[model samples]
Target: MRETLGAEDPSLEVTDLDAATAAPGDLSTLASPSLFGEPRLIRVGGVERLSEAFLNEALRYVESPADGATVVLRHAGGVRGKKLLDAVRGGAGGGIEVPCAEVKRDADRSAFASGEFRAAGRRVAPGALRVLVSAFQGDLAELASACQQLIADTTGDIRESTVQTYYAGRMETDAFAVADAALAGRAGEALVLLRHAIDSGADPVPIVAALAMKLRSMAKVLDAKGPAARIASEHGMAPWQIDRARRDAQGWETAGIGRAIVFAAETDERVKGAARDPEYAVERLVRFIAARGGAG
Candidate 1:
């Protein structure tokens, strides 16, 4: 809720209930006119940890709140916490809940990314938005921070390549991106990002494992002949993602994907200890996959 509100109003007052110096009675005292007779806007925050006495006082105040006071309560969504939340919900009349869950949907992530860039007085291209979503792992806070960092580090419109370059270490160049590049027939770009992942400290073994997972997904989609929607629903994948996999699956038979998965497993084992130069082993695996795709 704070994040959403902060996006609109930068003058939001945030107070930690654990560190609040005043009690509910303090609201009345604070809102009282000073020697100069000037009016003030009082907004009490952090009622989640209010003491029993303070809670009663606060509840009473909310029952008939002062004429121009706004009280915002932040509570964890729990059965015990629901009492205070219900009080505010039943009385105070306005509030919003900010669930502490990571944003995973592409649309939500894109909106968050776009909002962050726009807030900083910059524009991001559509392709760049997808790149940001892919790289940032759908963490809204991290995406927001990345946008701010980019705004501070560079000038003008931020591009996809720029985001990739500046956020190489911060971003996860995981096998998902590698699979995306390879399945799209951008083997050169796939190899480049694979190297970037190695340079950025991702172990070759896990990279191989990620590749194997991608191959397995393709194989699953290939084997399923039911409705794409039903297949995607069963597999917990977006329809569009499943659609892309279906298109990519056309180029590879189930046996071919099985071979790729086996290759990935072998590469994973080799990278752990068998292969002297793990980088070379990974490159060979990538080349073999690309060649197989080309052959198909």
Candidate 2:
């Protein structure tokens, strides 16, 4: 909004108000015509903790606002500001309602990263957006900062390789470690690591991706009848990765890999908000994968 509103104008002044202690007079000066005829932008933050006097003053200010000043009322959305909110909502003048909802889905975080890039006049590829979202999941601020930094530092479009270069193997290794634990038939250990990764602010989508990637690699090599180098090249994996997948697939028949893949897919859906408890869903996936390995 500041960008669109021409914040660079020398005549524009900004004021921050703590609504709890701010009186009507304090707010009145903000909306009043500046003696020097400058425009004012007043931001009244924490309206949810507003005092009666503050609310009354805001209401009064709403009745007759100054032409040269713009007043912005901020709230954290709670019951404490019910009266003030209702009054503003019911006002004849009407106000712009900007709703900032929490981001819960993988797609949401991706869209957020895309928006940040778009706002900075940069184009980002879908793969890069996904990588950025996964790298900074559950933390919008960090994601936004990274996006802006890329915008300021780089020119033109951003690709998945660029994002990979920026974050530098952030949480992907941890996510893969969880997948390794589950695939090695250590369900109990996998659960503990999964919990630790999640509680440490790891994104569930990437964790699920790591598992799927591991299983897919295993399935590929398990069904192959060629040299490790040729098979690894065909599957777009490193020779070492193929060798590791071969080792991990030791106890599994082709049937077990298929069943594990199915369970992993089911858990993927469950973790993406389909289940009541995503952590529980992941736990079940690990256990099922491990059990399938043992059965094979």
lDDT of 2 by residue, 1-296 (tens): 53545455656776778888887589997778878888788877778789888887777777777787777787876898777777777762365567778666554666667788876678988657655765675446557678878887888899878876877557774586688788888888888888888888877777887888778889988877877878766765545556777888888888888987887898899889898888777777777777764432
Off by over 4 Å in 2: 1-169, 293-296
Please give the RMSD to the true structure for each candidate, in Å.
8.5, 10.5
Model 2 per-residue lDDT at 145: 70
Error of 1 at 285 (Å): 1.5
Model 2, position 80: C-alpha lDDT score: 85
- For candidate 2, the TM-score is 0.43
Clashing pairs in 2: none
Query: For model 1, how does the per-residue alpha-carbon lDDT over 53-97 read when each residue is reduced to its tens digit?
Result: 666666566666654334555443345445556766554545444
Q: What lDDT is reached at residue 162 by model 2?
A: 83
TM-score of each: 0.51, 0.43
Overall local distance difference test of candidate 1: 0.64
Candidate 1's displacement at residue 240, Å, is 3.6
Weakest lDDT window of 10 consecutive positions for candidate 1: 12-21
Kindly state the number of residue pairs that clash in model 2: 0
